[model samples]
Structures are given as structure tokens and as C-alpha cells.
Target chain A: MKSNLELLTIETIAEGFRNEDFKPSEVMEAFLENIKVKSELNAYIDTYEDDAVSKAAEFDKLFKEGREDLPILSGIPISLKDIFLVKDKICTCGSKMLSNYVSNYDSTVKKRLDDQGVIILGKTNMDEFAMGSSTETSYFGPTLNPWDHERVPGGSSGGSAASVAGRLAVASIGTDTGGSIRQPASFCGIVGLKPTYGRVSRYGMVAFSSSLDQAGPLTHNVRDSAILLDTLSGFDNRDTTSLKLAPTKCYEALKKNDFSPSEFKIGIPYDLLREGLDSEIDQSFNLLVAQLEKMGFKIIDVSLPSSKYAVAIYYIIAPSEASSNLSRYDGIRYGFNEESTPETLEEFYVKNRSAGFGEEVKRRIMLGTYALSSGYYDAYYLKAIKVKRMMQKDFNEAFKKVDCILTPTSPELPFKLGEKKDNPLSMYLSDILTIPANLAELPSISIPFSISSSNLPIGLQLTSNKLCEDTLLKVSSILEREVGFKSKT
Target chain B: MVEKKEVLKISKLSRLLIEENKIDSFLKNFSEIIEYINLLDQADTTEIGKDEEIVEYSFRDDSEIEKLEVEDVVKNSAKVENNFFAVTKVIDEE
Candidate 1:
């Protein structure tokens, strides 16, 4: 029963507290203990042990007193990708530069979660500054995939994904900049949502690519993603990109259960399936299509012509923005400072950044700076933006004929840690299928579909039009129930 | 292929110091990535003008508030002096 309680969903945990079956403190203890047991996975950068226990205790008191003012996610233990700022807490952003940096203010997402009374288990790990496709670039070390201990939990939201898959927490928050959340979620065999780009605020999220970065949830299943989204998303004056639109009513839409596969037009982009797709993944995907056909959804062949160039586009734009965003990390204001005095300020800047950042982070920063450099700006940054426009056009055109598009979350299964560490480009390819969704600024979710012959999990990606996360969630929940792919971790 | 001199220039421009020994490996990786991104040259974007707005952002009111205390602002600084961040001196007196 204790084990069962550890894996309970947000809804179940809330109901359990309401019924007086268990208190929020028990849930916190269970997760905290599980987190300790899974420490070797390197899934968390730090855990909020005292803060979480105290929060849970306070919530339990409210529950015991029969307070009607309790928030929806009150007492649920959730992990945060170290990228989100929690006031007075260390937000390393999985990089050594800001290893000791503490945030003075809460990110909109963190503040929202706090308001809802969600117990933060800790800050999960990720790629350094959300640059890489794998968590290997993290200064804290790579987060190992819980499913296969030898393989990586996909990143840059890898630790968040692993935490949910390992049942360390009910659900966790992760940011997706070119598929950081979804790709890792796919690798770890869990539900990861990358909400519409502006649907969630990015006020205190350390900027990777300002245009592409979005914060969303990673969970064991779909409903929790919706519940987290319902609470985490809203307008924030702090983030200019934050949507001024009304609440998406994501949780309420899930309860409606008013979905028909027959009525919704699902598009299959044959372009994604043709090249570099693993045979086993292709077979599993075909089987899924057959199941959807039997369920009455019309699968139309749609083409995202410019999607083939998505990785190239993402690499250019993300790095260019990163080069600019990370320029603020010079040694003076905050972060790692070099002890040796330099004759010039420029020397201090160069030396501090060189010593502070990891290899991959430096590579991208250089790449971005080069792309945004005078001579190459037209060839790289400008060209990538044009391609981005075309990619967005491709998705918009596809959506005209179909309600949503279906694709594999990753082209291949989760690979062994250090497999692609030496070859950075090969590592970047893992996010090929997931990158287009971010490039288009669309809502996408990765739901576990099957376990591979080697016992690794593979996920199916569903992307809907911008702000159509409700449609994406409804279809994903239906498929989640139908597939019922039990997570073995 | 990028030359070592070019790599040095780019690294200096980026304000990131690449170690002298690692320049060769950095050049190889940088060139390969550049070659990969050159595929964008094949895309015909003549119809899409630079004036075409890709994203529209909503602005917020410019109300200023005392959000962070001076202590919190300088909390993470390597050196703080009188509520101000202490940095290496940039100007030298004649």
C-alpha cells in the first residue's frame, strides 16, 4: 500500500488526503525516501527535504481541519527542472557557472505551483543551460534512464523525466526548447507535454532560446499533465511572451470525455517515417496506426516539407539566442568567479566563462556567436529564420486538413549513456522528430506506446495546432488508456 | 573547412576562450556543424520577406515595483560592497 501510494496520481493523492486515508506528509515522506533510494540515477540536482516536509505538514493540517480552500494539487509531490527559479533556492540550470546561484524571486511556474500548494520534491537535472539532446552535458552529471540503467534519460529535461519514471514524484516540470521535455519523456517511458510556446510563462526560466523555450509537465500518465498544466499556466506580466488569452480549461476538457477518433482527423507525416527511422519503431508505429484505424480515426497522409531542416534551423536560432542570453553570465554580478586577477575585464570574462561552462555549452555559444556574427548572419541566422517560417507554414497547412499530427517521439530507442557524447551531431539527431513541434510553436505530447525488444520504452508524439493542447491531451489520454503500456521502472 | 586562425577569431568574438590545444578538434566539430547547417541554402525563401513578422508578443504595463531587496539582488555576487556589486576595475587613472 505504501508503494502504491508512492505512484499515485495528482487526483488520487488529492482524493486520498480528502478521504483521510493518508496525509500529505506521508506522500512527501514516501517520495523523499524513494528519491534517496534512486539517488544513483543522478535524477535530481538537489532535494527540498525540510521545505517539502514542512509544506506537507502545513497542508495536512489544512486537510485535517477540513478547509475548503485547498488548491487542486495541494500535497502532491512534484519535481522541478533546475531551470525554474524558486525564490531563495539554488537554480543551477544544470551548469557550473551558476552552481551556487540562488534566485531572489520565484518563476511564474514556481509561484503558480506554490499557490496551488504542490510540494516541490527538489530541482531535477538537465543538459547544461538546456543546450544538448542528452543530459550528459549537465554539470551535476547525467541522469540515467530508470528503465535501462545503462542508457540516458533523454534531455535537456532528463532528470525530470527520470524522476517521474522512477516514481520519485507524482509529476515534474520540464522546459522544452527544441524537444527537451518531450524527447526525455519519450526516453523514460512517461507522459511529457510541451505546451503551446506562450501558453506558459517564462519569466524566471533561464533563457536558452527565448522564442522556443516553454515549460510543461512530465508525468506517468496524461491526466496529471493536464492537472499540472491547468495550475502552471496563466498570464504573467513578467513574461512578455506569456499568453494574455483566457485559461485553456485543460483539466475541465479532460473531464468532458467528449472525443471521437472518428470525428477527429489525424495526420501521419510520411516524411517523418521514411528516413532514419528504426525498423522496430516503424513496425510499432504501423501497429498503432492499425489500432487507430480500427478505432475509427481517419489517418490522412500529410507532409511537413520543411521539417527535414528543423534540426538545422533549431541549432542556428537556439544557439544565436543562447549566445546573446548567456552573455549576462560574466563573472561579476553572480555565478562562478575566477580567483586570479586579470589585467583586463575582457580577460576576466573569457577566463571565467571558459572555466565555468562545459564543453557542449561552449560549443553552442560559439556556434551561436558565429552565426550571429556579421559575415555569416545572412547565411546562418537569417536563412534559419526563413526555414523556420516555412516550417510553421507547413504545420499550419497540415492542420487545415487534419486536427493533429502523429509521429514517433524519437527516431530510435534510448541509447546507452556516453553513446553519443563524443559525437555531438549524432546526439542532436535524437531530437529530430521532436524539434519541429517547438520550431512551429505548437502543443505536443509524448505518450508511451510500447516497450522495445530490449525492454526500452518508445513513445508516440501527438502535435496539435497552437493553443489546441486540449485536443492533444484528449487524444493522448484515449491512447494512454488503450495502450496501457505499464511502465516497468 | 575552417582555418585555425578563423576559429581563433570566432572564439575571441564570442568572448569564450578555447584552449590552444583543443583548437584543432573545435575546428573539426565547428566545420562539420557549419556544413550541416549549410543545407538551408537549398531552401527558396525569396517570397518570404524580412519584414514578415514571425511572432507577435503582448506587452505588459510598465509599473515599477520594489520586487527584490538590494540584499537579494546582491546575494549571489562574488563580492558585494555597500549594496553594490564589486567588480574588477575597468578604467586606470592616468
Candidate 2:
């Protein structure tokens, strides 16, 4: 009596496709129908119906022709965060500024996804230019938390994480700048990884905060994230910041499991857990630690002395970088244009931007410009970078004694959608536990820990040193098994 | 509290127009955020040196990048003329 496609993981669906249990087109139809009925969730800004069907049909034909060596992601439908370019597709980056704009070239990430035969279901919504923590700043409207239908899904990757958690897409890719990906993943009770900063290329991915932005996957499980990471990561000459390290076999690395819990040391930063955290989350974290200790991991007290200043440093540095990165949106090139003819060039710039951008985007841009202004550059911007280095040094020192660090992914659970929208400071504080990873350029993952009394999902975050995703994934996968939290469709 | 004039100055510098009615409320929130981030002033960064390894220079063969088509380039513009984007006249006609 099950007319709908089964809620399956990306790995399960790929195996099903290989075995011909269900065609890709059939799965795509079911997902598209689900998205239509659940439109109230606001998880997707657009879904490619005709294109997805045709692409699925092409994959089915290839599979039928006995192409046993098909790419791992072939026919797997996924969603993009709207920041990455997909040639000829509208990439709004969740802003009115680029509402009608189409990309002429595919971003490096899109090209890699295409090469592996991954079909993009559509471009998902996000915070306008990836700015806000709740996705409330998106010009299209906020993406609701699927779990409660009234709470936020967390952002600027809210739509990306929500799409996967709601079973609208098998997996989704989102960019993280100061916990955009990990925080939303935690809120939605899905697996979200922000790979080390340069682990993925940024070419043609709409720039937010250049130094901190790294695109990663959102999935229901760590294995799917590892699968997507293996496909999405590599060196691309187009992005100068792209790392030169050899691509990892993350999926295979998950199987190694060479280390035991007895040999592992987990770091708990007392300063991060001191205050401003929900008691429910603190309880969940304590339970997780107890479970780990039962499995034999020795918990060590670690100090990230500079972490208390991370939020203050992040607000200054990210916005300062954003202000510079966003200057390319002048109407004379591409994106929203002023309707009235301006008499002066300055008037043209002001009119187009003022009309195109939302309130938060403009606010950040102004704040950034002030911070980087001539007189205050040394006091605000430069000082922030110095503190950023100290934050990184703290992590480098902590890793010496601990295999990985554990913290609450967010200070609180998924909150009501409009609760903190009006208070920008409160929205910014939501990322407190997750921002240190971005500041330190380390790989971090958020996995479900337990369920709240209010029936919402709670998450625990794990962090490892630079380029140490294998350790993070290994630890998270073990935790995922012990927790065994089920995701509701 | 920040002066009203300073808000206007930053807005102009950012090339964003703040509506007259919204400026008062906007400045209030802006001041609060500014005050919050000012907590960094308490951190003693005296021992931290300037970020020397910040930039990593990677050079490639000097070559022209493939340019986007004129049609695609001008598609989102409000006005275009003869394969060029139309913009406000920069020079004055005396």
C-alpha cells in the first residue's frame, strides 16, 4: 500500500538504482510530488521537474544498457544552496538582487557533481548572500523547520539542511561561512559537515566571506556526507585558495576503524559550556559524554582561551570580508537593476543596491565598510585578524592532547521562526558554539545526539585539526550508531 | 550612541540608500551591534604579531580568461546598447 518512494539514504537509493528496483525517474517524480504538497515548508526556491525527469531517464537508459561502472552519484538527486553556479540556472543566492540572474558558467563544485552524474533537483533557498543565522533574511521568505513547522531550520544553509531532513532531496550541498552549514544541520537534526576551509574550491560559488566560506554536504548520515565529500573535494586551479593536498577516499576511510575508543582522547572546552546554553542541551551533551566514556574514551579538559572572543572577532572579520566580496554586484554588470534612469554614477550604485538588497545585507555591508574605513581599519579589522590567529593557535595546541573536540552544536535547540528575527544580536549568538571551527579553519560535523522534551532534535558537534576530516567522520559515525536517532520524514 | 550623521556617512560609503524613515531605527540597531563587537577591545593581542602567513601567492601562466558572451553578460542589465551595457553618463555635457 506504499505508493510513495521509500525514505532511503543516498547510498540506499544508489544501490536500488543499480539493482533496477526503482528507476531514477520514478524516485524523482515521488520527490517532486512530496515537495509540491509540502510547499508550506519553503525548503526549495525552485525544483527542476522537466530537467530532472529527462536527466533521470538518461541515467536509466545508461543503466539499462548494462553500464556497470556508472559514477557513484549517477542519478542521485541533490539540492544546491543557490550560491553555487549551475550553468544557465538562476542562482539567486537567496537575494532579490540576483533574482532574475542566470549563471553563464558552472561553479567548480557543480562541475564536479555533474561529472559524477549527480542530478541537481533545484537551487534551494538561503540567507540573503548567506548572512543570517535563521534563513529569515532570505528575500523569498524563511524556510520553516520541518520538524515543528514553526521553528527555524537554522541557516544560512537552512534550506539545504531542511531539504535533506524533510526527504525532499537525498542530499544537499551548502556553503559555510561562520557555521552556516553546521548550525543549520544541527538545528534540523541532519548530518552537516564543513570541510576544512580550502578543502573545496570557491570558483563561481557566489562569494560571501571569502576566507571562511567552504561548501560541504548535508545528509541524513555520515556515510552519505563522506560519499559526497569524496566526489566534491579536490584541487581546482581556478580557486587560488584551493588546497594542493591529494583527494581523500573518505568513504573508504570510514571503513578503516583502526583506532579504539580507549586510545582516543576527547577534548571538552569548559569555557564554551559555561553559560548561555540551554539546560536541555547541556543534559544531552552530558549524556553523550557518559556514553562515550562507557565506550572507553577518556575526556580531557581543554582550554581554548581565545574562544570567548571568537564571536566578536568573527562578526568583524566576516562582515569586513563580505563588504569587499559583495562590491561586484553593481547593476551595470548583472543582477537587479534600477528602474529609473540615474543622472549620476553614484546615484546609480546607490539606487540599484538599496532596492536590490534586503535590510540585513545592507546592514552588514555598512558595518563592514565602517570597520574597514580608513581611520578604524587598524582598530577593528586588523585587530580582529590578530585575534583570529590566536583562535587558530588555541586549536593547534589543543589537538596535541585530544583526538577531537566535542561541543554543543548550538547553544539552544531549534527556536520559533520569528522569535529572534528582529534581534540581530540574538540571531548572531546562535552560532556561538559552531563559529570557532570556521575561525580556526578546521573540519567539523554536527550529528544528532538526542531528542528534546519538546520533540525537537538536539545535536552534538565534533571538531578535529586541519585536514583531519577522517578522524571527525570516524568519531561521528561511531557516535551516530550509539545514538541511533531516527530522522522523521 | 552613534551620531545620525555617522550612520549616513557609512551608508553612503557602502553605496546603500537607507530610507529616511528607517534610518532612526536602523541606527539604533547598528549602534547596539557596534557596541557588542567592541568587546574585542578587552582582548590583549599585544603579543600577537601581524598576520604574516595570511597570503599565499600562487602564480599561473599569464593568459586572458575566456569572457562571457555579450548577450549573457547584458541579460540582467536594465539597459544595453550595441553590445555594451548602458550606464549613467559619467561626463557632463556642458
Candidate 3:
């Protein structure tokens, strides 16, 4: 047996299980042991030990009985970010307000995964309310980067990315409101996908910004991401925003075993390279482009000028909607309520809310409220919306000339925890490259490309037009094979 | 320019009470954020439309639907009395 199961890809795990070389229960036990040993990473909020064990036992029984109804992920263990509701489990969303709140129903994604026979490993930690770029805002404390314990695992989905990188679980589900999934995935040296908004059902997901919030898989490679997306994507009557189109059978596309790099037209955004990106990242990105060119893919220089305003516009629009969506957690319904003797009903409302929310959450709510307020609405929120429309148009035009757009996921690798805590603006800049995908409602993936001189992993981002995740995965699979940076669990 | 006083006002509206000690730091940080956002005001938006069109949709009539009894609504509350949600009195007589 390997010293750590970190190097186990989904393909390898599935092959092993199919050949009867190892049982699902044994794999689950190995992950549990690794999680315990690497407890300092703080990757999980809750582990479903009995649930995982029972599921694994059921899969083992089915295997012995020669039943074949189970899907490809019949015995795979997966972690869920704290935001996605798992019935009867604590879905805290990394906030003290919902710390004791047990979900009464499984989220649509969770239900679909369960139907596929994927065992629920646990719930990973996250930033409170998915508000921060780094998981440092988590009420339970931040999840550490698996590569370098001192640096952050890129965040809101920090714990999910860290757990997968650290090999605590095979793959995890993460919610990306802005760059929550990709940014952390970049920092942790794993693959993360933010499926186009409406690509996955948001039925039981706690809303941050309904427009920007999307759920996708964080896996070890593009194939696993495609498989997870196959299980997770579909139309649900519960989420009105879910696309009415038939659910994409992404896994079938990957299973076809096609490896023609000449078929891919990789779009390179020249503007991103000339901007505020780190020099090392720029060099690594050029090296990646050189490798792809050698593989016969045409590297076309495309321009998305409006992308320069993504972070500024995202902050405004996301917060504006977040302020409205979060208004439901007024302490009386589903969150923490303060025991205060107020002189008026209004005072009761004030005191409870004042006590419940954390500093970062409060800061965002204030900024959002002011942006949407009567006098300032047109100046801030509405203006941001217009810019968002333009940004989407820019992407729509860019996709016409290329198969996929590629860029560095983060300008630089993960910094040490607490390094950017005091400077909120600088922290917001970390998601500069990723926010455009969300704004455009496009599918994007981040895969680890190289390690920095400091041994921190760097991520390369590949994005495709809406509903074209197949193309994105195909390109990513080719890159993964060429780059060959497998997890060293 | 956003001032400390303005920050306090927004805090009150948002129901976030920043302590007196931390108000200055919060104000400074907020000012910097606002300054960064203000750069967008310089963009040429002369062709942009100001008025947004609101779309209205028709829904099935609910006039014939029976309303839920007050008892049903208050049944899940931890404490309820006389078809009302019970709680500590929030207002005091002057």
C-alpha cells in the first residue's frame, strides 16, 4: 500500500475497485486514517463516519453480490463543503449564526450524488457565508494549504480544495460565488470546476448571491471533474434558474479516449499577461503556452477588454444581491437570536442581527445595502450591473473565435495566512482573474500547472462558453497529461 | 467623501454596531475601498441606458385558495398563545 493515498486518481480508484484489488471499505479507512493524521489542516467541519462506513459496506455487499446497478462512482468517497445541505447534518455555511442548524433536506446536488452511489465522506470548512476570498473568515478557523501549511488554501471553498489536495477524501463539492472554488483549488494544487451558473441545481444551496453562486466539483484531474459534473448537473424543478436543456453526459465524452491536441484552439488573453500578474506566474504561463503549441494547438491571442473591470464590478453586484438574499437571516427565522430586552420591535431586530453576523459579513452587508439603497442604487449597483452585462458580452464575443480561453488562475501562489487579512482590498484582488467567468455564467476549470520557487502550487485556468464543459475538460485532460503534476499524497 | 459619521449611519442601518474604538479604522478602510470603486465613474457610459425595463408575469389566480389557519402557522413555534407567536415584550411604555 502507498504511504498516503494522495496519488490515487479517480480512474485509478475505479480500476482498483473493479478488479477487486481493494474494497471500498478499505479505501474509506485509509482516507479516515489520513484525515486523522493531518488534522492540523482543519479541512473538515463534520465527518460522517458511520454514514460513510455503512455506505462503503453496502457497496462492498453489492460488489460481492455481483449487482451492477451502481454507477462508476459506486464506492468513491467525496467531501461536501459546509454550505451544501446534507439532511440531518450540520450545514453551518461557516457561520456561527447557523452553527447548530441541522438541515432538514438534502440539497439537489447531494441527492443526485447519493443516487449515484457516491459515499458522503464529510463536510469541509469554508469562509463564513462564502463571503471572503480566503477561508480565513471561517468562524471555525481557516483551512491550511496542504502544500505549505503556513499559506492559505484559496478560499471560500478552501477546506474542500485542501482536503482533496491533502488526500483526506477523493474529491469534494465546492460552491463558487466569486472565485471560492477555483482560487482555493489553485492554491491547493487540485483541479476545481465552476460549472456555468444554472448548469447545476441550486435547490438547497444557501444563497449568497443567487446570480453568481454556482456549485461544482473539485477533483484531482479533469476526468474526475467531468464524472462528478455528470452526477451533479441536471434540471431540477425546485431551482427555477436551472437550465431546461438535457443534463450533459460529460463522463461519456471523457471515456471515448480521444487525445487530439490539434483539435483545440486555445485562446490566450494578451491583456491579462501585461497587467498586474506576478512575473513567475507569467513565465510559467508562457511555458505552458509553449508546451501546448508544441502539442499542435493553435494559440490565438484574443482580447476581452471589459475583463479588466471584473473585480470592481463583481464586488458591487455580488454584494448588492447578497445584502438582499441574506436579509432572510434576521435571527428570528433560522439563525442566531440574541436575548435582549429591547425598547421596541426595531431594536430587537437590530440587536439580534448585530450579535449574529461576523465582521466581514457585516462589512459586506453594509456595502451592499448602501449600494442598493435608494439614493445610491443607480450610482453603484445599477452601474455595476450594466458593466456586468458588457463583460458578459465581451466573453460572448471572445468565445466566437476560440474553443477555450486560458489564463493564470491566481496572479501569484497562495500567501501566508493573515498576510492580507488587514487589507480587504488586496484580498479582493486575488479573484481578479476568476470573477469574469462567474459574471459571464461560463464554465471554467483550474488545474495545478507548476510549483513556485517556494514550492507552492500555481494554477492555470481554462474557460469555455456556457454548456460547453466537454470542450473545457478535453483541453484540460490534454494539459494534465502533458504537465504531469500528480498529487504526491 | 465618506466620513466617520457616515460610516456610523450606514452601520446603524445595516444593524452592525462598530464599537467606538474601531470606528476610525473601519472608516479608513471603507474610504480606501470607496476610492478604488470611484475609478469606475470615469468610464464612458454615454450610450448606456439608465432606465431598466421591468418584466411582469401573470400567475394563476389564488383567490379561490384557502388560507392557512393561524393555528397552523404558529404550531411550529416554541411558544405560542391565542394564535400569536409569544415572546418577551419588545416595547416599553414611556
Candidate 4:
């Protein structure tokens, strides 16, 4: 049995409401009860139970009045990762620096969700400043994996993925920078999509490597992901980077019956799978490739040689951007400020930041600062940017021959908590495969392919060229139908 | 190679305070990372340009500035008095 009402997919919940099988208030209460029972997961940093109920009640009234004007996501409960600002709520961004910080305005995404009548379940946990891949670096404490509490549910967007995987929330919004969403979604056995950069506005998301960050959804299935993406995507003048392309009616895209495998070509990167991948994952990925071939899709071998350097390039670029982006937190604008008087302005800036940020965040900030420093800029940061360009060029070349690239989202399965805490390199290597998509500004999705014999979740990643989210979703939906993994209760 | 002193300097540049006791461990780990990054320097980057299109512009706006009241800003802090945030003194004044 499902543990709570909030765990149901948006489609399922909407269908039930339409059938009058259960009231919207009943579903809201079920989610509140589930939150109480699953406190150990730390999936939520804060839940607006009263607000959610009121919204659900409002939706119920709309149903009673037979209002056809209701939005597509009426009464659905969606979790927001702490990084996204929800007006008047504490939007801590999972950092000690902003632990008590509350937002006075909603992010464009939040306003859109609210306008569409999606109920805000709560704010989910994340890596401190969305830096780590394992969610272990969250200031609020690591979110336990629901499948096995000892292991992490991938990170940066780990809590959002875990909440969806554990059925705590039907769907969630997570920010992806260097694989924050897809990696965690892979580890947690769910669907996570990072749309083309600028497809979603970044107006009120607390910045972390601003150029690379894009918010996407984590959901149980591809259809739900497409539905959420439809609402989430579109241009907003507030975010200069927001895309100005025509709005895609993604829900309508889902209904098209032309999902024949013969129409698609799949690309597999042989080198990426050969070196860093685990044996089980390789076997599973090959098996999925074979399954796709049997289903009538053409498979082709593709090369993206520069992608080998993506992890190194991403680490430098992301941190460099993060260093600059996070500079505003020097105790003056929105975070903790040290009270002591300093002889110089520089010393005051140093003291406030030194006291405010946590260890992992500080480490990245320093790594970033050094890369961007005067003498080293050409040697480190600038070189990474060049590599980033080549990585994107490699993808551009590869996409000329194939509709999508398929690979294991993560090379290895989830590791035990604290296993790689002492070794930052090992942790960084975990996100190697997924970072290239972010660097290329392409769209990718991670869908649970098969569960290990050990019962841990393993994910298959499907990546399409820039703004080709439709094909990615169509392919993922076909695979989801074939693989058939049940959602965890 | 990144030296121990360099790590300390980078730490200072980034506004991070490394306790004297943790310096040894920090240096050992940081040097390993720097060594790994050195691998990128050896790549045949002859074709790679110094000015690449991938470099993103900074997301700050210099055109429109919104001035705020000092009172409106400090009113939300948990510990504030005299239009300033109260905290433990961090440095000695000259």
C-alpha cells in the first residue's frame, strides 16, 4: 500500500479527484501524516502543512463548483529544493550561511507553480550551496536513501530525488549543475530531467555556478516529468538567460502516438562506459541497448573524445563561477555578519565569510578563487573554459549522427554514507559521466533501468541535443513502459 | 605542485580560516587535488583558444540599482540592535 496520499503521481491524484474517489483535503492529510512518519529521511527541511491544506481545500471548492478554468496541476503536491525561493518562506539554500534567511519574493518557477494551483508540500534538503554529488554535505544533515538508509540518494538534488523515490512527494523541482539532479535521480530510482539551459528561468534560485545551473523536475514517470516541465519551462524577462523559444505543450507532446522505435537512433559512447563504469552497470546498459535494438531502434557507436576531460573542466568552471556568485554572501547582504570592527574593509569581508560558510562550501569557494586568481587564471580557469568549449563541440558533432546518447547515469551504484567523505576526488569522480551534459547545455534524463541483485537502483541516462527534450521524453517513456519498475511506497 | 603555504594563501583569499591543527591534513589533501589538476596543463591544447565562447558572462546587473533602507535590511536578523547585526567580534580594530 502507498504510505501516503502525496506519494501518488499527479496523474493518479488528478484521476482520483475527477472520479470523486477521495477528496483533495484527504490527500493533503495523508501527505502530512507521511511526513511525520518519515522524519528520519530528512527529505524535507520545512513543510507548509497548513498552507498545503488550504490550497487543497481551495481546489476541492473549485471541483464542487465545477470550474473548468482550474489549472492543469490543481491539488498536486510538489516539493521544492531549498535553493528555489518560495516567497515569504525560509529559502536557506541548504547552507549555514543562509540558515535563517527567508525570501520576500517568489522565484519565477515558484510563482508559476502557485499560479497553476500546484500545492507546495515543503522545501527539500540539498548539498550546502548545491556543491556535493552525494547530498551528504547538507548543513541540515544528509537525507537517508529510502531504498536503503545507509546509502545516499544522489545529491545536490538528492533530497528532491529521495522524496520522490520514497513517495514522500509526487514530484519535485531540483537544480542541476554538473549532474546534481540526474545523478541523484539515478541513485534513488526515479526520473530526473535537466532541461536545456535557459529553458527554465533562474530568477530567484540562490546562485551556485550560475551559468550551469538549470532547475528541472524529479518524478516517478516520464509523463509526470513532461507535465511538470510544461509548467516549469518558458521565458521570463526577470531572468536574462531564460529562453525565448515558443512554449512547448509538453503534455500534448506526451499524447502523440507516434512513439515507434524505428523512428529513433541511439548513440552509445564506448570510451565513457569502458573506463569508469562498473561491471554490473555496463552489463545492464548493454542489456538495455539490446532491448532497444530488439524494439526496432537503430544503435550507433559515437565518440566524444573531449568528454573525458569534462569532470576536470566542470570542477574548475563551476567553482570559479560559484566563487564569483557566492561573493555576495560576505555578511553584508543576506547572510551572517561578524560584529567585530576591522581596520580594513578586506579584513571585515574575510572574517564574515570565514565564520559564515561551512567546510565543503569553503573548500569549493577557495578552489574557485584560486582558479580565478590573477597569475593562475590562464593556467587553470581559462583552460577549463577552452575544454568546456571542446566538450560542447564534441556533443555538437556527435548529435549530427544520432538523436540521443545513452549511458549509465552513474558509473557505480550508491555507496555507504561517509565512505568517500575523506576523499573528495572519489566523490567528484561519481558525477563524471553526467557533468558533460551540463557543460554542453543539453537536455538529459535519468530513468531507473534495473535494480541490482543487491536491490540498489541503477539508472540509465538518455541525453539529447540542445532543446530536444521532446525526443528524450519520448524515448524515456518507451523505456519506462518496457522496464516496469514499481514506485517505492 | 601546490605547497602547504599556498593552500593557506588560497584559504585566506577565499575567506576560509583553516585551524592551525588542520593545516597538515588540508595541505596533504589540497596538494593531491592540485596535482590532479596539473594533468590538464599537459593536454595538447594547441588548438584551444584563450578566448572561448563557452565562457559565461557574470549574472550581475550594473544598470539598475535598488537602494534599500538600512532598517528594512537588518529588521529580519535574529540578533540585531542599533540598525546593525549583533555578533561575536571577529577582529581587533586598529
Report, for every candidate in turn, its global Cα lDDT versus the true structure. 0.89, 0.89, 0.84, 0.85
lDDT of 1 by residue, A335-356 (tens): 8897778889899899899999
Number of backbone-clashing residue pairs for each candidate, in the order shown: 0, 0, 1, 1
Ordered by DockQ, highest first, the candidates read: 1, 2, 4, 3
- Give the DockQ-based CAPRI class for model 2: medium
The C-alpha stretches of model 2 lying farther than 4 A from their native spots are A1-6, B64-67
Count clashing residue pairs in model 3. Answer: 1
TM-score of each model, paired residue for residue: 0.98, 0.98, 0.94, 0.94
Evaluate residue A72 in candidate 4 and report its C-alpha lDDT on the 0 to 100 scale: 63
Q: Whose DockQ is higher: candidate 1's or candidate 3's? A: 1
Scoring only the A-chain of each prediction against the true A-chain gives TM-scores of 0.98, 0.98, 0.98, 0.97
lDDT of 4 by residue, A1-489 (tens): 334466678888887777777778888888778778888999998899889989889888888777777776888888999999886788888887888787866888899888888999999999999999888898899999999999998799989998888777889999999999999999999999999999998988999987799999999999999998999898776787887766567778778857778989999999777787888988888888998899998999999888888778887888899998988886765677666777676777787788778778888888888888889999898788777787788899899999999999999999999998988888988998899999999999999989898898999899999999999898888888887487656
Tens-place lDDT digits, model 1, residues B1-94 = 8778887887898789888788778888888888888888889999887868645788866788447788888988888899998877999998
Mind giving the per-residue lDDT tens digits that candidate 3 earns over A1-489? 544444587778877777777788888888988889999999999999898988888888888776656678888999999998887788899998888776767899999998888898899999999998779999899999989889899899999999999999999999998888999999998899999888899988999998889999999988899989988887776677887667788878877967588998889988866878988999988998998899899899999887888888887888888888877776654566665666766676677677777878888888887777778888888788777777777788888889999999999779999999889889988899999999888999999889889888889999999899989998888888888487756
Worst 10 residues of 1 chain A by lDDT: A1-10
Estimate the TM-score for candidate 3.
0.94
lDDT for position A409 in model 3: 94
Task: Pull out the clashing pairs in model 1.
Answer: none
